[model samples]
Target: MKVLVTGGAGYIGSHAVQRLLRDGHDVAVLDNLGRGHREAVEALRASSGKEIPLLEADLQDRAVIAARLRELGTEAIMNFAALAYVGESVTDPLRYYENNTAGVVSLLQAMQDAGVKRFVHSSTCATYGEPEVMPIREDTPQSPINPYGWSKLFVERVLADHAAAEPGFAYAALRYFNVAGSDPDAVIGEDHHPETHLIPVLLNTALGKRESATIFGLDYPTPDGTCIRDYIHVSDLIDAHVAVMNELDPDREDRRQMIFNLGTGKGLSVKQIIDAVKEVTGVDFPVEHGDRRPGDPPSLYADPRKIREQLGWSASITDATTMVRDAWKWFQENPSGYASQA
Candidate 1:
């Protein structure tokens, strides 16, 4: 399979590109370098020793994308492009909608034009905002409280609509929870500007990037009085994407739109994650308690049974200790992320 991976220069996208290549598929990366670093993609190409062509173009240009898809003979598109910050979405709803939602529209149009029907979308568990039940399922109510979630939900809705109308169109929306850790080999890792993720933040604190890690809302109803989230390893998340591509048979008569939640089916609280980080790095970094941010649920994890039963996919490296240790290895290798090399 020849696939084009949007946002392939970003953390997760870069990892997915490596996974796809390892699965014996050709991949081309398309990224605008707005929120992604080109160095990650270059590092991947260097590490893998493969000529992964990268198209530095924005998704908004439908005509160019359509032409490029045709030129590259792309059989599928794996979209990981979008503004993903929840708090930033709350502050700038239009930006989220335009980039996350509207960007999908542009990509879908290009796919339709190029006769590329197979798509693997990067959705999020945030779409199931404030769920009443634990271990969220595929049928869980999607009531996003933030624009980031809404943006991804809108893309999912549009993909469903397209699939229903066009029999040739088939898509898999992988709704993922908190993705942590890095490539086990430390080839590529998470590096977001003004990073908001908990694991990386704690690791950075251990590296003395900041004075200490801030514990947000230490009064939640969880066991540790903090929010609990399912942290999926980056490697496992990429494996799920590969599983989706392998399972998607557009030629099948009973082909249907696919939706699955990707996670470890285990929730880890903020305090527990901090403890894991301390254990992995052997450092007790300073911590400061702060009020909880708005729209944050007390706990969020996934059932993950559907994907396991259907695709034979499950988190193989998502344990808390392994996640922290792998992430620590990446941080040690690239203390300042790709910027140090730049």
Candidate 2:
């Protein structure tokens, strides 16, 4: 399959690029490099020994992207390009809509122009927005509390509508929970500017990159008085994407517009993640408990049975310790992330 991976320079997307190349698929990357690292893509090239093309352009650049898609003969698209900061989305709603929501519309338009039918959208569990249930399902009500969630949910809607109108179009929107860890080889790993994810933040503190890691809202109604979230390894998450991409046959009625929640069907509290980092890295960093952030649910995890039963795909690396170990391996080697390669 000739695949075009959007945001293929970022953490998850870069991992996808590596997996695709290893799976013997012809791959090209499309990233604006605004939030993604060119170094990550370069590392992928070095590791895979493939001169993978990296198209440095925005998703909203419809004409240029369409031309590139046609030139590359792209058969499918795996979109991971978006501004994903929840707090930042709250502060700047328009930017979220413009980039996260409007960007997909433009990409779909390009897909249409290029005659590409298959799409694997990178959705999120934030779209659920504090569901009353313990394990969220694909049919669960989507009531997003933030612009980031709404931005992604809106794209899902667009994909659904587009698929409905075009019978031959196929798409799979994988609503992911907390995606952590890195590639097992440590060739690439999670690196975000102004890092916010719990695992990376805790690992950074353990490495003495920061004074301490703060736990927001430790008075939640969980066993540890902190928010519990399902942490899926980056490699496992990309495996699900590859499975969906391979199964996206528009001729099959059930496979036209697929939606699945990706996770390990288990939840880990923030305190548990902190402990895992300390244990894995052998550093007990200072921990401060702060007031709970608004809109934070007590627990959010996926049922994951749908993907398991249908696609025979379930998370292999489910434990927080193993995730921390893989992540620690990368952090220990590259304390400065991809920038260390320079």
Candidate 3:
């Protein structure tokens, strides 16, 4: 399979590129190098010993993307290109819709031009939006609270509608929870400007990169009075993407849209994650409690049985400690992240 991974220079996309190459798939990267790091793509080339093509272009450039897709003979696409900050989305909702939602529209146009049918979309649990249910499922009603979630949900609808209308088109939208940790080998990992994810923030505090880590909402109605979220390892998340991509057969008569929730079916509170980071890094970092961020649910996890039964895939690294340890290893190796290489 020849796969074109959009945003392959970013954290999770880069990991997906690595996994695809490891699994014997010819891979090419299409990243704008906006939020993604070029050094990460270079590192992947060095590690894999393959001259992977990095198509430095945005999804909005439909003509260029379509030309490249045709030239490379791309069989499938794994989309990870989007602006993914909740707070930022609140302030600038239009940007989220333009980049996350409208960007996919252009990409789909290119896919149509190239006659590519299989797509693995990087969806999110935010589409579920503060559900009353404990374990969210594929059938869960989607009522997104923020523009970020709405942006992704819009794409899910686009994929579904496109698949329904177009014959031989198939897509799998994996709505996943909190994606944590790094590659086990520490080759390429998470590094976002103004980093927002919890695991990296905790690890940075432990590394003395920051003075302290702030725990938002210590009064949530939970065991630790904090919000709980499912943290899936980056590797495991990529594994599910590969499984779905491999399973997508456009020639099959029954091929259509597939939606699955990716998680460990386990929830970890902020307090538990903090403890795990402390134990993993052996650093007692300063911790501060703050009021809850708006729209934050007390608990959010996934009912991963559907994906498990269908794809025979489950999170291999379910322990918070192990997730923290892999992330800690990456932070230790690249304290400044890929910036130094740049």
Better of 2 and 3 by lDDT: 2
Tens-place lDDT per residue, model 3, 209-231, is 89999999988889989989999
Clashing pairs in 3: none
Candidate 3 Cα outliers beyond 4 Å, as residue runs: none
Please provide TM-scores, in order, for all candidate models, with all chains considered together. 0.98, 0.98, 0.98
Order of quality (lDDT): 2, 3, 1
Ranking by TM-score: 2, 3, 1
lDDT of 1 by residue, 37-113 (tens): 99998888889899999898888889999999999999999999988988889888998899899989999999999
* Cα lDDT listed for each candidate: 0.90, 0.94, 0.92
User: Least lDDT summed over 10 consecutive residues: which range in candidate 2?
Assistant: 289-298
Candidate 1 residue pairs in backbone clash: none
Report the error of model 3 at residue 168, Å: 1.6
In model 3, the worst 10-residue window by lDDT is 249-258
Model 3 scores a C-alpha lDDT of 0.92
Answer with 1 or 2, whichever has the higher TM-score: 2
Runs with alpha carbons beyond 4 Å of true place in candidate 1: none
Pairs that collide in candidate 2 are 217-292
